[model samples]
Target: MLFSESIRIAVTALLSNKLRSILTMLGIIIGVGAVIVMISIGMGVRQNVTNSIASLGSNMIIVTPGSTNQGGVRSAAGSSQKLKLDDADAIKKKIKNIDYVAPTVNSSYQIVNGNMNWNSSVYGVTPEYLNIRDLTVSSGSFVTQSDLNSRNRVAVIGTTVATNLFDAANPVGKNIRINNQPYKVIGVLESKGQSSMGTDQDDMVLIPLTTAQERLLGITYIKSINIQVSSADKIDMVQQQIEELLRQRHHLVGDKEDDFTVRNLTSLMETMTSTTTMLTLFLGSIAAISLLVGGIGIMNIMMVSVTERTREIGIRKALGATFRNIMMQFLIESIVIGVIGGLLGIACGISISLIISKFTQFNTVLTAAPTIISFAFSVGIGLFFGIYPARKAARLDPIEALRYE
Candidate 1:
């Protein structure tokens, strides 16, 4: 029989048992859909992480106080008071290829504007903080040098803080009390959304370093310093220079550990992206197992089909059908089932990904590569699993098959 005839015969046979064919294809459909959905979710998570890190701005580096060792008990990073305003100033004055350096002292305070009160993160920083963070004032202006120089009681609020404090009214030029120490609101920052670590980036307030130290936190030491390098290539070099400078300033000997840590945000982005990619692969692998199960189902159903059609196979062989023709018929049936399942699975997977992204916090990205790969793999699965049953049908003795039942 011709190959086209074999396909016609195979399709006819599947159509004759429509319910069974549909049932057999169910596994493949579910397996393909699951794999696509899982991969899309993984890719989405990776993308979200990358975007969040990129949102921190280009060539950003953070310097925080390092651990302290006392009686062999070491403290966490930022436990020491080594990161100070002087460190930030020195970095700005001495470091080459540096754009901005902003020393920050962090504390939490209850902010009050008449009857409305909200607790927010208070950051004591200089005018350079806005530049280092890539933040802009939507209205009014950011903290000025004069504000820092004279320790003026002025504050800049983030979008979240602004909305919570003043509702729809403009917050700039208004006075809001910070820890009951009245401060003038100088500016409102644009929305920054959330950080990679899930912290609300737009729920804080900015104030002058001197004012925070003198009035609120009552500390001369800063929590961290934000540094923006001029170019991406200069991040490592600048980080090394900052470490060396801090070491010299802090008077660290050869054996003594430094009292500060410098973090490269670019390096962090690479690490996190790599991690998420691996996780995506792992999830894809797990989902692929379902394809194997689906293939096994196809094999099992094909075997049963071969047995039920043994007399038909015998009749075909007796009428001059070649063993290759007989095998091709069953093989085509299996491939058809797989191809149909794969196509349906693609639709289901994409739909599921869309639903997940729309309804949940999980980010989902559906791309062509995974869908194509899954479909191709499903076709391969059909070819691999169909072989044994097709060969069995082809190898049967015509006389014995006819005489059996």
Candidate 2:
């Protein structure tokens, strides 16, 4: 028989038992939908991570004090107070590829502006800190070199602090108290929603390094140093030079680890991306298991279909229907079920993904690749599972089939 004629016959037989056909295709529908949703979730998470890392800064490197080991006990990283302000100055004077370096120390404090008060992070920073952190002044100016040199009690506030302390009033030139000492607000930084680490960026205060060290915290060591490379290509070289120079300055000899940690944000981002990609593939693979289960369901139903139509098959054989024709007819029926189920599954997956994204914190991203792969996989499943049943039906003996009622 012609392929078109076989297809027409197969579709007609399936339509005659609409409910059964639908029930048989339920597995495929659920499997495809699940795969799509799972893959979308994985892709969305990966994208979020990438965006978060990008938001930190471009071509940035962070240096922090390393662990302290004394009397056979080693403390955690950043626990030691080995990083000095001189170290920051030395790196700046020596490093050629470095664009800006900002040495900083921070602590949380309750800020009071009249009766309105809020607890916020306070940082000791220089004018260069603004450029390294990509911070912009919405009003007034950032801490100047003169402010740092003279240890002036000037402050720059974030949007969160500004709103909580001053409300609708402009924060510039306003006086705010930190650690019970009055500080004049010199600038208000533009809002930076959140960091990759999930901390609110716009909830801190900035003061000159000299003022914070002498008048507030009263400590000599710095907590960390932030370095921005002049260009992307120079990040590795700059990081290496900084490490080597720091090691020499700290007087670390052979086999002795340095007392500081230098981190490259670019490398950190690449590592994060690789990890997320692996996670996405793993999720996709897990969801694909349902497709295999759905295929098995198709095979079982097709076998039952062949058994129920034994007498009809005998009649067709008696009427000069070739073995290939019988096999093709049954196979086409299975394929139709698969194709229809797959289309429905695609719709189901997309609708559910959209709903989850809208109603929940999860942001799902749908791509054409997963949808296409799922449909094709479902069709392939139908063909692979239908083969044995179609062959069994085509091989039945006409004489015996007719006598068996």
> Over the full model, what C-alpha lDDT does candidate 1 score relative to the true structure?
0.90
The top-ranked prediction according to TM-score is: 1
- What tens digits encode model 1's per-residue C-alpha lDDT throughout 45-146? 899899888876789998999676767888898889878888889999999999888888888889999999999999999888887778988998888889
C-alpha lDDT of candidate 2 relative to the true structure: 0.91
All models, RMSD in angstroms: 1.6, 2.1
TM-score of 1: 0.96
- After aligning candidate 2 to the native by TM-score, how far in Å is the CA of 308 from where it should be? 1.3
Top lDDT model: 2
Q: Which parts of model 1 are misplaced by more than 4 Å? A: 194-199
Tens-digit lDDT string for candidate 2 (153-231): 9999999999999889998998999999999999999998876445788999999998999899999999999998999
Q: Name the weakest run of 10 consecutive residues (lDDT summed) in model 2.
A: 66-75
Question: How many clashing residue pairs are found in candidate 2?
Answer: 0
